[model samples]
Target chain A: MTTMTSNALCFGDEFPASGAPCFVQVDGDGLTITVESEGDDGAGEAVPFSALTVSAGGLDHDHLVVKWTRVQGERTLYLKSPDVIRAFRETVPNHLSLPFAQAAEQVQQVRHRRRLVWSLVSGAILAMVLGLWFGSDLFVELAVSWIPVEWEQKLGESAYRDFLSHQEVMKEGPAVTALGEMTHRLTEQIPNNPYRFEVTVVKSDVVNAFALPGGYVVVFTGLMKKAESGEEVAGVLSHELNHVLQRHGLERIVKSLGLLTVAAIVLGNQQGLVGMMNQLGVELLTLKFGREQETEADLTGLQLLQRAKIDPSGMIRFFERLSEKDQGRMEWLSTHPMSTARAERLKAELAALPKKSPEPFTFEWKQVQTSLGSQPVAAP
Target chain B: MKSEILYPGAFPMVRVDLAAGEHIKAESGAMVACSPTIDIESKMEGGFLGALSRKFLTGEKFFFQTLRASRGPGEVLLAPTVPGEIVILELDGVNEYMVQKDGFLAGADGILIESKMQSLSRGLLGGEGFFILKISGKGMLALNSFGAIHKIELKPDQEYIVDNSHLVAWSSTTSYSIEKATSGWVASFTSGEGFVCRFRGPGLVYIQSRNPGSFGAWIRQFIPVSE
Candidate 1:
C-alpha cells in the first residue's frame, strides 16, 4: 500500500488587505472552488460535507462556508473542496512553500536590471566612438582657430613659399605663352571678376588639366593632343576657367588645408602645412567631382557656351564622343569620365537654350595647337 | 586656351579656372561662356580627404540652370573636361567626316574608310582614343582594346565570339552571350581568362586593346569583389 503524503498550498505574498482576498485551486473530477474571506480570519475551519457543496465551499450561496478565528499570531488559509483537502493531506509536502515563488520573482528583477545597465554602457561606448570619428577634426579646427592670429598667417605664408619652390620643375614655353594669352582673353570676356586670371601650361604630357585658386589654369601637353580643334580645346579650358570663376578651386584648397590648420595649432610646426599641400595634390588627382558638381558644370558650362555663342551643342556632342571612346577605359572614366547620357542631357539643354550669336572674337587656336608640335608630345 | 566669339555674334568663350571666393559679375548683355571643366592636378599639392571632399563638393550641377543677362538666355556656360575628349560631327550624306576632335574643330575631312586594315592599325596601335566609325550605308561602330575585329555575317542561325569591349556597335537584331572563358582544367591553365562576351552571326564587331584601360577596369572592380 502506498503511504499518504501531504502537500501545502501557497498563496504567494500577502497584500495590504485592501479588498476581499480569494483562493482558487482545482479538485479532482471536473470540480473547482473559489473562496472569498476577510483578513480578520474569523472564518472557522472548513468541514467537508458533500461533493457538490464542498466543491463550492465559501462560494457565497448554496456552498460550504467555513470560518476560523485567529488571535494575533497565526496565519489562516481557506479551503473549500474535499478533494483539495485530501490531495493536500495525501501528496503535498509542508516544505512546498510560497517563499520559493517570491525568491524566483526577485531573480527575474535582478536580470532585468542587469540588461538595462549593459545596454546603457554599450550605448555610451558607441556614442564616444562616433564622436571621436566625425567630430575630432572639427574640434581640432575650432581649437586651432583660437590660437593667436599671427600663428595662422605664419603657417599659411610658409606653405605658400614652399608651394612655389616645389613647382620649380615646371617651365614656361609656347604652350604656357598660349595659355596666358587665353587667360587674358577669358578675363576680358568675363570682365567683372575681382581676382586676375592666370593660365599655366606644364611641359609634362600626363593628359591632365587642373584649375587653381588665385585664377590659375594648368594644362598638360598630353591633354592637348586629345583635342582636335579650338572648340574642343577651348571647351576644356573654359570648363576649368569656370571652376576658377566659380571659386571652386579655392574651396578645395581651403578644405584640404583644414586639417593642417588644426594641426598647426597643436604642434606649431611649419612642416604640417607642407604635408597638407602635398596630400592635397594626391587627393586632387583621384578626386571625381560629385554628380551635382558635374551636372552644374555641365549646366554652367553650357550657359557659358551659349552666352559665348560657341554652339553649346558642341559640349554635348563632345561628351558623347568621349563616352564612346572611353567605353573600354571605364576605370579612367570612373575617375574622370562622363557618360553619353550626360552629353545627351547637355545637348538637350543646349538645344533648349535660346541661341544667340556674339561679337566675333578670334581664337588663335592654330598657334596653341601648333605650339605642342615643337615640344615632344609625352604619354598621357 | 583660346578665345573666340563662335559664329557671327555668340558670347565670348573664355578658358580659365575660377578659384574659390571668386565671382564673375555678369554684364547686362554678355553671352554665356564655354570652357573646360576645372582640373586640380596642376594646381594643388596634395590629395587629402578634405581636399577630395571639397573638389567633389564644389562642382555645380542642375537639371536646367539658366544664366540671364537682362536679355533672356544670353549667358550659357559649357564646361567639359580633358584626358577626356568631346567631338560633335555633322553628317553630310554617305561620307563620314571628322568634325571636332576633343573640343576643337578638326579642319581636314579625312576619308571614311571601312577596311578592317585601317581598323586594325588604329584600334591596335592606339592612334586615336577609340574610333567612332559612323558607316554611311550601315551604322555606328565602337572599337575596343587590342583584339580581333570580328564580322559576323549570317542568313539566320550562326555563332561568333565577341568580347563586350570589342563590341563596337550592334544592330538591334543580334543575340549575345556572356560566358566563362573555359571549363575544367583548361580554365586553370589560361591566365586571366573568364567571362568572355559571345554573340551570334549577322553583326559587325570592333576590337581594340585587350585589357581595358584604368578607367574601364575600375568600374567592374567592385562587382567581382562583391560576388
Candidate 2:
C-alpha cells in the first residue's frame, strides 16, 4: 500500500540523445512513469513490475537499469538515486528480486573458489620442492654404489697426475719422509682397504690439503710448516685420507651430474662414464665437499687416529687453532668452513672414546719444517 | 555512405561507396582496393590507451583504417583475413551489440567500438575471452565470421544455448552465462563440446557455422614437426 515516488530518466524507443525526465511511482503491481513536460497531463505510462528485467547499467554501473518491451519497441529506465533503488528492491515481489540476489551469491562463490585454487597451487609447489630436496640425496647414494672402484682409481690417478703437473711436488725431502710416515701409519690401520693410498707433498705457501676420488692425497708444505707437531700433520692426513675412504669426492661429482646423467651411468652407459672421467680431473681441483660430508670425515678421521694409536686431540687441536688464528689466510679453513659448533661436536666425540696414551712419531717435527726451503713459494 | 556484401558465402567482402568527405572505419589491413579519390589513414580510434587495451585485452587490431572520400565520392573494397561470410547489422540508437574478438570488419561513421569486460565466470570459461567488443550508436556495422553467419531472434525470456567458440555477436538485451556444454564435466569435454553460453533473450543472437579452434587443430596434424 506504500507508494514510493522518485525522479527517473526514461529512454523511449527512439533513444534520444538525452533521456526525458520523469517522476516514477511504485504501486502494488507495477511502476507508473509520468513524463514531466509542459503539455502532457497526469496520464503516464504504466509498466508491470513482472515485465521488467532489472540490471546494473551506466558507464560505471552506478545506476540501476530496468528494461521492458512496449508497443513501439524496447524501453529503458534509469534509477540513479540510492534511496529509490532501495525502495524499489524492498517493494518489488520476491520473484523480481531473485536475480539480483543470485548475482551477488555468484560473485561470492567465485571469490571463494579463486582463493582455494591459489592455496592449492602454492601448496603443490612447496611439496614438489621438498620432495626434490630429500629425494635427490637418496638418488645420488644409489647411483654412486653402482660405480666400480677400479674406475674410481683410474679417475683419481688421472686427476692426481694432472694436479702434480701444475705444481712443484716435493719428490724427496725430510718433509716427504715425514708425510710418508704419517700416511703409512694411517693406511696400516684400515681393514680391507682397497686404495693404494698415494700421498704427495706440494711446496706452496697456502695451508691446504685435499684427497682425490681414489686414494690420492695432496699435502701443501705450508701445512707442514704451520703444524706444531708430527701428530698435527698426521691428524690432517688422516682427515684427508677419510675423504678418500668415504668416496666423498665421487659423491660430489655424481651429485653434480644431475638426475639424468646419473641415471645413464647407473644404467651402464659407457659413453656417460667416459664423458664424466674426462671432466673429473678439472672438477676435482675445485670441488668443495658439503657440510655433511665434512662432518662425516671429521668423526671418522678421529676414529682412524684412535686405531692408529696417534693422539686424536692433535686433529681437534689443529682445526680449533686454525679456526681462531688467521682464519681468512688458511685455505684449509676456507674450504672446510670451521664453525665453533664443529669444534664443539669434535670435542664431545673425543670425550666418548676410551682413554689411550698415543705414541709419538720417530721423525723430529722441527727438522721436517726446516727441511722445506723457506723461500715462501707463491700460492698457485 | 552505402555498404553491400559481395560474394555472400565464402571469401565475402564489403564494398562501401562513400559520399564526399564521408568515412568508414575498417579493421586495419582489411582494404583490398580503393578508388583514387579515397584517402586511407590508420588511426587509433579511441586514443592510445583505448587502442592499446583493445589490442592486448581483446585481441583486436591496434589501429583502425579509416577510408575517407576526401577528394570526391569513391568506392572501397574491404575483406577479412580469413575466408568467411560477412553480415551487416543496422544499429539503431536504442540497442547495443556485444561482438567476439576479430568479428568486426567495418562500420559507418556513427558506430562506436569499445572494449567491454564480462563477468568473471564468463571471462574465464566462456572461450569468447575476457574482453569483447561493444558496438553501440546508430550506423551500419559489418561483421565477418570464419564460416556462414546465422541470426536467431528470441522472444522475451526465451532461452537458447550456443557453443562459445561459434558465437559471433548478440544483442545487449540478452543475458548469458558460461557453463559446461553437457551436465557432467567429464562428458562435456569428451563430447568435444566443452564450454557453452546459455542466453535468455528478448533480442537477437548471431552464431557462426564452424568453430575456428577445431579447424586449426584439424590442420595441425598434417603439418610436419621438426626436432
Candidate 3:
C-alpha cells in the first residue's frame, strides 16, 4: 500500500501509467481510508470510480477524506462529499466499491426474504394455537350468552334437520310426491354438485327457512303458502343457500372441535380430545356463529338472490310478515329471533339494490296457492 | 325430420320460415312443466387423484338430468335445487331472443348448449378445454358422425371397457367401475396407459374423441424426457 496525501490527489487526476496496478492509503487530519484496484467493465480502460468506503469515528471530524488505490489504465476519477461521509460513517457501514457492494446487496436481500418467511410461519403457528385455545363450547357460550336467548336458539340448531323432523307427520302417500318434486327441483338447481342439497318442506305454519351443513335446506310449508310468488320462494331459498355457502354449520363444528382440542391439551390426555368432541353433539346445539358471520351470510345471500334475479326485497317483506304474524308469540321469539330492527335493516339493504320489475309470465299461482292446503299451526 | 324442442320458461314461437300452415312439433310450456335434459360427463385432464376424488364425490355414471323450463325467462336454468338464473343468448338466427345470463348464445329452435359450455368452461378453467359437456337430445343425435346407428347392449353383469376421455354420455342409473392392467410394479408405474373405465348394466355410452393421453403423446411427436 502506498500512502497518498489528500492534497497530492486531485478529484480529476489522470492515471499514473497504463496497465500498472497500485493501492493507496490516506491519513488526513484524523480520518483514514484504504482502497485497491478490482477490474474493468471490459471497455478497454479502467472503469470510473463508483463509490467510496469509509470507517469513521466521532460526530465531528476534520474533513470528509477518502483515499484510493490507483490502477493505471486510461483516465479515472474520484468523488467526495465531506459532510455526508462523516455522518454516514458514524450511522451506517462504510461504502464499498462496486463488486463488493453488489455482493453485500444480494446478501441483504436473501437475509430479508428469510426473515419474512420465518415471520409468516410463526404467525401461522400462533394462529393455529390460538384457534385451538379460544375455540370451545364453554367459551362460546360465555361469549354468545350476551346475544338474545331466543335468537341464539333458532340459528343454533340445524335448520334443515329440524325441518325434516317436523315433516315426519306429513309423510303419508302423495305428500312424498311434493317432497320428491321439491327435491328434484332443488337437484336441478345445483347440478354437478356431488353433495346433494336436499330441500324438505315442514308442515308448520311458521314463516321460516333454515340451512344445514353438507348441503341441506328446509322451508316451512307455511312460509311457502305465504310466499306471494315463486320469486319470494327463490329469495328465501337464496338466503338459506347463503348460510350453507358461508358454512355456518361447519363453522360451529370447527369451533366445537377446536374447543375440545384445547380442553384436551389443557387437561393433557390423548383420549381427552376425542371424548370431548364425542360429547359435543349436545353441547354444540347451543352454539351459534358470531354476529359477524351472520352479517356476512346476509350480504352473500343477497348477492346470490340478485344473481339468481330474484327480488331481494321479498326477504324483507317476508321478515315483516313473519314479525306481524307472530306479534304475540314471544316464546316463539326465543327460538325465531324476529325483531323490528332486523326487519328495518333488511329493508334498508333491499332499498339499496337496483330495482327491477319481475318479468311478466303466465302463472299457475292459484294452483300453487291451493296446493298449500290448510294452514297448519306453528309447531309447538 | 322429427325434432323435440324444449323451451325452459315461457312459450315463445317463431313463424318457422315455412308456410303459415306448416308447423313443427316441439315441447313448449313454462320451465316448470318442460325443461331440457342435461347430460354432463367430466374426466380429469390429468389422472389418479382426479379419478379417485371423482369416484367418491361425483356420481358414478354421467350426470343425466331432465330440466323443464321454470317460471323464469325461457333461458336455460341451472341449480334447480336452490336457484340459478337462466342463460339467455343472442345469435345470428337467434338474435331476437333475450339473453338473461352473460354467457350462452341462442340457436334455431332452442338455445345452444355447446357454445355456452365452451364459454363457461373457458371462464371457469382459465382457457382449459371443457372436460364437461352439456348436450341436448337433438345435439346428441345431430353431432354424431355415423348416418346409421345400432344400439349395443351390455348384459347386467357384463363390463365394457372404454377410455375416460372418449366417453360422451352414459345412463345415470349405470354403475361405473375402473379396470387396470396388472403390468407389475415398475411397468405400471412408468406406463400411464394401463387404466380404463368399466361400465356395468345396460346403458348407451357414446365415444367421440380418441384416448386423450395417446392424442397428447402423438401430437408432441417426440418424448420430452427422451429429448
Candidate 2 chain A weakest lDDT stretch, 10 residues: A1-10
Candidate 2 residue-wise lDDT, B1-227, digit = tens: 78999989989889999999999999999999999999999999899999999999999999999999999999999999987899998775545778999799999989999998766567778778879999987789999998899987755456899998999998765678778988999999999889888886546788999899899999999999998
Candidate 1 local distance difference test against the native: 0.40
Candidate 1 lDDT at B107 equals: 11
Q: Chain B alone: TM-score in each candidate?
A: 0.30, 0.98, 0.36
Which is superior by DockQ, 2 or 3? Answer: 2
lDDT of 1 by residue, A108-140 (tens): 554465557656866899988997688764554
User: List-wise, what DockQ does each model earn?
Assistant: 0.00, 0.12, 0.00
Which scores better on lDDT, 1 or 2? 2
Residue-level lDDT tens digits of model 3 in A1-380: 23432221112123221111222222222222222233222222222223343221110111222333445421221212344343333434333434334544554554566567667866999987887587554456454333332322323333434435536434533333444543444345443543456566667766556666656666666666666655556656766666665556655654555444433433545476445433543454344556666666666666656554556776666555656764432332343465787667676776787776644223444455566684433333
TM-score top scorer: 2
Candidate 2, residues A1-380, lDDT tens digits: the string is: 12323266566645332354567777888888776542156668888888988866442234567788888987777666666677777788877788766543554565567567656866899988987787877767777777778867877887798789989988998888888888898899999998899999998978999999889999998887777788888888999999989888888988886545534543556777666655767788889999999999999999999999999999988888888777335999888988899989999999999888998888987777778865432222
State the lDDT of candidate 1 residue by residue for B100-163, as single tens digits: 1121211111213221111222233322222322222212211112222233442222456544
| Stronger candidate by DockQ (1 vs 2) | 2
Q: Could you give me the TM-score of model 3 versus the true structure?
A: 0.32
Backbone clashes for every candidate come to 108, 0, 22
Report the error of model 2 at residue B103, Å. 1.7
Scored against the true structure, residue A196 in model 2 reaches a CA lDDT of 93
